[model samples]
Target: MRNRLKSNEGQNRRKKRTSDVEPVFGHIKSNRNFKRFTHKGIKKAELEFGLHALAHNLRKKVS
Candidate 1:
């Protein structure tokens, strides 16, 4: 894994992956203080996360 990331192609891929995905998680965890799921079951957990993602998208769109 270290060697792969050391290559040029892997470097570009890692950069793209982090740029696209990491900020949203960082914002959700740090800014929103969302650390864990309050619900217990899988269905409820999915719904909760879906709602959070929806709200994030809506907020991003509005701003």
Candidate 2:
């Protein structure tokens, strides 16, 4: 694991992956105040996350 992280290709991939998704989650957690879900069941939790993801996508469209 340490050697892979130290490799040039691995470092590039890691930077690209984190840059792509980190901001979206940071925005969701900070701006949307989505620290935790209120729903209990698996189905409800899925629905809740789906809604939140949809909202995030819609915001992207508007901006």
Which candidate number maximizes lDDT? 1
- Report the C-alpha lDDT of model 2 over 2-40, residue by residue, as the tens digit: 899889988998999899988887888899999988989
Alpha-carbon shift of residue 33 in model 2 (angstroms): 0.5
State candidate 1's TM-score. Answer: 0.74
Question: Highest TM-score, which number?
Answer: 1
Candidate 1: count of backbone clashes, pairs at least 3 residues apart or interchain: 0
What lDDT, from 0 to 1, does candidate 1 have? 0.92
For each candidate, what TM-score against the reference?
A: 0.74, 0.71
Q: Residue pairs in steric clash, candidate 1?
A: none
Residue 20 local lDDT, model 1? 98
